[model samples]
Target: MVDKSARTPAETKDAGVLIVGLGRFGSSMALTLDRLGQDVLAVERSPGLVAHYSDRFPIVEADASNPEALEQLGAREFSVAVVGVGTSLEASVLITGNLVDMGTPQIWAKAISAEHGRILQRIGAHHVVFPEADAGNRVAHLVSGKLLDYIEVEDGFTIVKMRPPRETQGFTIEQTKVRERYGVTIIGVKSPGQEFVYAEPTTRISSNDLIVVSGHSELLERFAARP
Candidate 1:
């Protein structure tokens, strides 16, 4: 377990996730990350939004369009910043551009339009998300209610992180024949043993492990329901 309180200055510098503009996308992103044990700082122009999430998340009250606000929030130091300014396209673009200028790596922005997405790409955003599209998928899957997180990396391959059924806790990769069974391969296991998981075939599946498998989404679903 990472000792959050015992973190040194070096550690603190290494550990940072910044969120600019606390609308629905930003707020949910912050909440989800905080729930997943990551320290998140959300910066919003509105004082009301800042106050609402201040107790749960570290928040800064500042205008995202202003470069000075980025400085105030120590934006340059973040390892990955989420510029989730969904309300205004201009504000989202501005925040993303400023973060790029400041050399913050791995910025994920929630965009509304094709032109806005293109602008974000030109401004050096690492990832662009469409929240309405995501919400629709989330809602559709809620009825199905099996998938945990569906991350479309590239090509036709999608990374589905899901919970295994009760029976497969102590099984081996070879024993499970996961690849042949589901038409998808168990790429990795994110075990909560102080760090991340491995895709090694020999790695045993534990009950608490977060199985991060990659393949077609359809095949990934089969793996999610198996023993």
Candidate 2:
């Protein structure tokens, strides 16, 4: 519902989301939200970058580090704002502060380092994501050849997909005792042909089956490490 035509702070209208910076993280977030049918307004400082994505979404070319620049874009009306200036800690912190001052309901920021993330949080960023770190962790799991998928649902818990360990193959779901032993739950099974089935206590796990389970990440790692 944001008035894309307004390029000055004098205009006021409501918007669902505001994205600052159009790097990989920013552009990806905007596109994904747009794909999910959300209204998104993106801003980038580079004219060339703005031109490239101009046809894809509504974008404004401006320095997001400046509070007046964002205010002119009606940033205060957006419910959520994401600051994605990964390479510039100053820009990220400044933009996050601007959004916070504007009273945006939620503000997410991208950080390239631990210190950068802590600073953003200290300055009122609601969430800080480390894309490189997260991607590296996933790659490490997949490289091990046992893990197929990993989704971190919370700080300590995750939903993981992996090939059953040698000792777990041929064991019934109940026999594995994942819940009792590891505080995990076997959500489902993916058979050889890529068929998925809701797992029950009597479900027999085959060597070729991929198990989908959810539990504390440490326990899941322990389960996967078993022979």
Compared with the true structure, model 1 gives a TM-score of 0.65
Clashing pairs in 1: none
Q: What C-alpha lDDT does candidate 2 achieve relative to the native structure?
A: 0.84
Question: All predictions: root-mean-square deviation over Cα?
Answer: 7.4, 3.1
Best TM-score goes to which candidate?
2
Best by lDDT: 2
**Over 4 Å off in model 1, which ranges?**
1-12, 138-151, 159-183, 186-214, 217-227
Candidate 1 lDDT: 0.75
lDDT accuracy of residue 47 in candidate 1:
67
RMSD of 1: 7.4
User: Each prediction's TM-score against the native?
Assistant: 0.65, 0.88
lDDT by residue (tens digit), candidate 1, 1-227? 11122223343475768888777778888899989999777777776776677778677777868887676556777789998887688888888988888888788988887788888998899898877876676556545746677776655578777776655578887777777767787777877764666767677888887777889766776667665
Look at candidate 1 and tell me the lDDT of residue 102: 87
Instruction: Point out where model 2 deviates above 4 Å.
Output: 1-15, 193-195
